[model samples]
Target chain A: MIDFKQEQDGAVLYVDDEQNNINSFRSTFRKEFKVYSAINAVEALKNLKSYPDIKVIISDQRMPDVTGVEFFEKIRHIYPNKVRVILTGYSDIKAVIDAINKGQVYRYIDKPWNNDLVRLAIQDAMDLFDTRKNLSDKNESLQSAYNELDKFVYSVSHDLRSPLMSILGIANLAEVDVQDPKSLEYFQTIKGMVDKLDGYIHQIIDHYKGSQGKQFGDRIDFNKVVDEIIESIKYHPSAQGVKFQVNLEQSDSFLSNKMNVKTILSNLISNAFKYQREEETNKFVEVTGTITSEKAEIIVKDNGVGIKEDKKEEVFNMFYRAKQDETGTGLGLFIVSEAIEKLAGSIDLRSTFGKGTEIKLILPGTSE
Target chain B: MSDKLSIVIVDDNEIDLMIGERLLSRVDQSIALTKFNHSTEMLNWLQREDENSFTTNTIFLVDIYMPIFNGYYVAEQITQVFDAFDKKAIIYLVSATIEISDNRKLMLNSRVEGYIGKPVTVSLFKELIKKHG
Candidate 1:
C-alpha cells in the first residue's frame, strides 16, 4: 500500500443508468473516500479516461444499453488493473460471476448491497493496484542498475588494464638495452607474469558479461561469424602453426546475440590454438555448424593437446587450468560455459588425452 | 612529402610519452618529435601561430583518456586547428582503451586514420608508417 494516501481525492468510480443510485453512492462514501459517477456506459468510460488515478470501478447491471458484465469485459484490456466490481440483480449474478476471470473483475455486488460491503471491496481493489504498481517500479530500477553495471565494466576494462599495457611496452624497450643474461631472463619473466595478469583481467570481464541475463536478438549467420572469429584469432601468439577448417550448413535462419556467440567460439578456438602440442605437425581446429529453425548445433573439434579424462568436468570451473605450467589462464572454458548458459544452451565435451578435443553446443532460438 | 616525417606525441603519463619517443627514435633517428605531457598544453602549442608553422605530413598520436577532455575531444580540437591553420596531419588514437565503441567512433572522424593499442610493436609501427608515410 502507498504510505501517502489522500482520501479526499477521487479514488472510486461508480457507473449506473439511474442518477438516483449514483447520488446515493456519492452521499454515503464521499466523506471516507472520493467518488466519481457516470450516468451511462459512454460517460463511464469517459470518467475512467478523465480520472486515470481512480483505482476502483463499479457498474450497475440493469443499465439500458450493455449489461454490467459486458461493459467491464469490453474495457478490461484498456484498464486491466482497474478494480472491476459488478453490481447486478439476483438473475444477473451468474453473468457477473462468469465475467470475473474474463474481465479480471475484482468482485460482484448484489443489487441490494450493503454500504459497508461495497466500501470494503473498493478498498481491497485499491490495495491490489498499489502492490502491482510498486513491483513494476522496482523492475524499472533494476533495469537501470543493469545498464549502470555495463558502463562500469567498460570503465574497469580500460582504466585497470591500460597501465599494465604501458608497463609491458616499457619492459619491451628495456629488453633491448639490458644485455646481461640474468637481467634478460628477468625481463622475460616480467613479461610472462604481466601477460598472465592481463589474461586474468580479460577472463574476469568475460565472466561478468557471460553471467548477465539474455541479450537483444539479431539474426546470426554461422558461416560468417565463424570465419570472422578465426580471422581475428589468427593473430594470437599461439596461432602460428594451427590450421582452421570450417563447414556450415545453415539454410534455415537462427537468431541469437552476436557477442555471446563470438565469446563462446573465440574461447574454444583460442584454447585449441593455445594448447596445441608441438610434436603434432598437422595441428588443426575444425568447426562445423548445423542450424535449424529452432536451434543451432555447433561442434568445435581440435587436434591439439586434449584434456585428461579426470579433469574434463573441472575445466569449466573458474581459474581451474588443466595445464598449470603452460602460461594458461584457467578461465577460458569457464567463460565459454557462462556464455552458453546465458543463451540457454547446452554443451557436451568429448576428448582423448593425447589425440584431440571436441566440444558440441546446441543453442536455442525463438521457435516459430 | 619529406623522407624524414615529424611526430607530435601527446600523453598524460610521462613514462608512456618517453617510451613513445624512444620507440619512434629507434625507428628513425632523424625523425622530428614534439612531445607533450598535457593534452590542453598541446592544444595551446598548436594554436601558437607566431611560432614556426607546424609542418604537414606529421602523425599525431594522442592518448584517449586524459584530464579535462578525452582524446576524441582533443582530436576534434586538433582537426579544427589544422583546418584553420591549413595544416595537414593524421591522427592515430593511441591507447589501451578496450572500449568497443572506439571502432565505430574512429570511422566517424575523418582526421583519425586508425587506432593503435598500447605497446605497439616495431612491426606494427613500421606497417602503419609504410602504408601512410
Candidate 2:
C-alpha cells in the first residue's frame, strides 16, 4: 500500500515520438506529477541527464529512431535507479517480453491506458526508488561508524598499554635490586596486577577485532589449530597439571576464517582450564573435532567443576559469571558466542553442577 | 673474538630506557650498554662512531612506536648502514602494542631478527642474549 499522494511528488519522464501523444500524456498527469515530456529517445536522454531527480521513465515502444526497450537498456547503467515503463499501441507480446527481460521495464502500458492503473504503477516505482535510496544511505552511514569505532579501539588500546608497559618495566627493574623478602613480595604483587591488566587489554582488543565480522577464508587444519592453542595456553599457571586430549577426525581440510576459529578455541579451552576443581586430581580436558562435507562439529568436554543448571543460560551474556572468580573477566564466553554467531554456528552446553561440563558446536562448512 | 658485546636500546619513553639499561646491566655487568630516548640521537651517535666500533657483535632493541622515526624506520636504516659497512647487526623490534598485524609486518622484514613484547623480563633478556649473542 503505497502513499500515492506522497509518491506523486516524484518527477516522471514521458518519451513519445508523436507530439500529440506527448502532449496528451502531459495534459493527463501534469497535475499528479512533475511531468517532463520528450519527443524522442535522444530528447529523453537529455532530459534524464538534466533532471537527476526523475524517478520513472515512460517510453513508447514503436519509435522512429529506437524502440522503448532499446532506450531503457541504454540508460539502465547510467540511471539504474529510474524505473522504466513501456507504452505501445499494438499487442506486441514479443516486444513486451523483450522489454521485460532486456530493459527491465516495470510494466507495459496499453494504447488506451487507464489513468488510475498508470498512476498506481508510477507510485509503486517511486516507492521502490525511495526505499532503495534510504537503505543505501543507511548502509553507508553504518559502515563509516564501524570504521571509526575500529580506529578508536586501535588507538585507545595502544595508548593504554604504553604507560602500563612503562610501569611494568620499572617494576621489573626494581624487583631485581630489592633484597628484602617483603619488598620482593610487593614487587611480585605489582607484576601480577600488571599482567592481569595486560590480559584484560588483550581481551578488549580481541573483542573489537572479532566483532568486525571480517572473514578471511583459508584452509583450516583443526589438528594444527588445536595443538597451537594448547601450546600457547599450556604455560598459564591455571593450566598446570591439567591433561589435554585432542582428537581431530577430519583428514580433509575445511575452509573458514582462521582467526575466528582460533579465537573460539582459545577462549573455550582457556575457560575449560580455568574452571577446575582444586580438589579433583583426575582433571582432564578433551577437545574433539569432526568435519564432514556439509558441516564441522567440535566438542569440548572437561572433567572439572561444572556450571549450575539454573545459571547456564546466563553464561553467554556479557560480563555474566557463575562463580566468584575474580580472574575471569566474563568476556571470554561472550566473545566466543559472538565469534560462533558470525561463523553461522550454534553452541550447546551440557553440564552437571559440581560434576563436569561439555560444549558442542556445529558450524556451516562454508561461509555465506 | 675478544671483542665485547655491544647493546644499543632506543626508546622514546625515559622510564623504558632506564628499565632497559638496568636489565642489560644485570645480564652482563661488563657489557657496553648505550641507551637513547630518541631515535635520531641514536642514529647520530651510530653515524659518529668509527667503522671499527661496529666490528664487535652488536644487538639493537628498537621500540616500534615513537614520535617521528619508528622502530621499522630505524631498523631499515640500521640494515642500510650494516650493508654499507659490511657488518651484521641483530635488530630486534620491541613494542607495547598488541597489534599482531603490525608485529607480523615488522617480522617480515629481513633486517628485523625478532619481535619482543614490552616489559622485557630478565629470563627473556637472558634467552635472547644466549640465542643471538
Candidate 3:
C-alpha cells in the first residue's frame, strides 16, 4: 500500500533580488527539478505557502527589503520542512552564524557560485526529503493494515464461535436426555471435542487481542484482578484439585492496562493448570505481585511438570509448543511475551524439568 | 395468562433462532415466546400494539448484527415507544462477536439492560429469566 521505493522529482525554489541570477539558476537546474523564481522575500513567502512541495529554498543574502537569514528565519515556522540554503558574496560572519543558528540553513553557497556544487547540494536535500516522506507514509499504511487485521481477527473468531457454541449447546442438551451408558459416553466424547474447539477459539481471540497494542492505563486493582482470574480458572476441568495462593503487596496505586496484565496472568496460570504432573500429589501454583511507585513486579511459580532444558528459549516463540499435549496451542506464552513487550517490560523464566517452573515479569507501573 | 412474562427473540440466522428457541424452552416452558427473523418486523409489531396493551413484563433478546435495522436501532425505537406510553421493558443485546469494543457504544445506551454472547445455553437463559422475567 506504500510507494517507498518510487523515485520523486522534487521541486526547488530560487529567491533573488536580481532577475539575471534567478534566470541563470533556473536554466542550470531546470532539467533536474521544477524551478520557481521569486524576485523578493514577499514573493518567496507567497510561493512557499502556495507550493508546499517545494523541497529546497535558495535565496541571495543581499536583498532590498530583507537579508536571506531574516527571510529563512521568518518562514521557518511556516515551511519548517523545506531545506534552506543561502547565496551571498559578502563574507559577513554574523549573517552566516545567524543563518546557521536561527534560520536553520542547511548550506550556504558564495555568490557567482559553482553550478555543480549547488546542484549536488539541492539533489542531496531532495533525497533527504523523499526518504523522510517515504518512511512516514510507510508507517501510516502499516499502522492501518494492523488495525484492519485486528478487526478481521475479532469478527472471524466471533463468527466461528457461533456455530461451535451451537454444537456444544446441542450436545449439552442431548447429554441430559441420554440414559444408556454407551450413548452417554458418546455424548461425553462429543462434549470433550467441542470444549477443546471452544478453548482453541478463545486462545485465537486472546492472541489477537494481545497483539492489538498499547491499551493500558493508570487504574489497576491487582487484588481484584487476581481474584477474578483465579475464580475463572478454578472452574476449568484441568484446575481440579490444584491449589492456588495469591499474595499482593502494594504501597502505591498501580497504573497499567488492566486487560494486558489480566491476559498475561491468566495465560500463565492456565498453563500451570494445563501442564501439571498427574502423579505428583502435591500440586500448587503461587503468585506474588508487588507494586512500587515506578514498576509492578509479578512472579508466578508452579510446582508441576516443567519445560525441558533444551526448549527453554524456544518456549516464547510463536506456535512453539514444547510438549505433544493436544491442549497446548503454543500461543499462550507467546501472547504473554507480546503483552509484556508492549508494556515496556521484561519476563524471565526459570524451570527444572519434572520439578517446577517460575516466571518473573516486571512492567512499568505508569503509562510511558 | 396475562401475568406470565413474554420473551421476544429476534435473529436472522435460522439455526440460531431454532437453537435459541430450544434453549429458552429448556429454561422455562411456560414463558410466552415470540420469534422474528427480521428486526423491522419486530419493531413494527411493538409499534402496532395498543398504548395500554403492554401489561405483562416483556423482555427482548435481539441479535446485534442483522440486515435492515440493527439491535441498537431496534432498542432505541423500543425505548421511545415504551417511554411515550410510560411503560417498562427489558432489552438485551446478543452477538457472537468477541470484540468487546465493537458493541461498547451500544452497551452505553440506557435502554439496553444486558449483552449475551452466542450460542445461547439453558444456564444463561435461566439466569436471564431469573434476572428479568
Candidate 3 lDDT tens digits, A86-187:
888857656876778764798888778998889888888887777778888999999999889867786677677777766776777776556888988888
TM-score of 1: 0.79
Task: Name the runs in model 1 displaced over 4 angstroms.
Answer: A1-117, A211-216, A365-368, B1-4, B50-52
- On the 0 to 100 scale, the lDDT of residue A154 in model 2 is 76
Question: Tens digit of lDDT per residue, candidate 3, span B50-93?
Answer: 76666456788889888889888888888888787655678888
What tens-digit string does per-residue lDDT give for candidate 2 at A143-248? 9998898788877677889899889988888888889999989988888888888888888888887876566566788888888989988889988999889987
Candidate 3 chain A: worst 10 consecutive residues by lDDT?
A: A1-10
In model 3, which runs have C-alpha deviations exceeding 4 angstroms? A1-8, A41-53, A60-82, A86-114, A176-184, A215-221, A253-259, A279-282, A294-297, A308-314, A320-326, A340-355, A362-368, B2-4, B52-55, B102-104
Look at candidate 1 and give me any clashing residue pairs.
none
Decide which is better by TM-score, 1 or 3.
Answer: 3
Q: Model 1 over residues A242-338: C-alpha lDDT tens digits?
A: 8888888998877777778878988887887888888999999888878986889989898888889999999999889877687778778888888
Candidate 2 off by > 4 Å: A1-10, A91-93, A214-218, A255-257, A295-297, A341-348, A362-364, B1-5, B30-58, B102-104
DockQ of all candidate complexes? 0.63, 0.70, 0.61
lDDT of each: 0.81, 0.83, 0.80
lDDT tens per residue, model 1, B28-97 = 6666789999988988887775323566567889888888777898898888777765556789998876
Docking class of 1: medium
Fnat across every predicted model, in order: 0.73, 0.79, 0.52
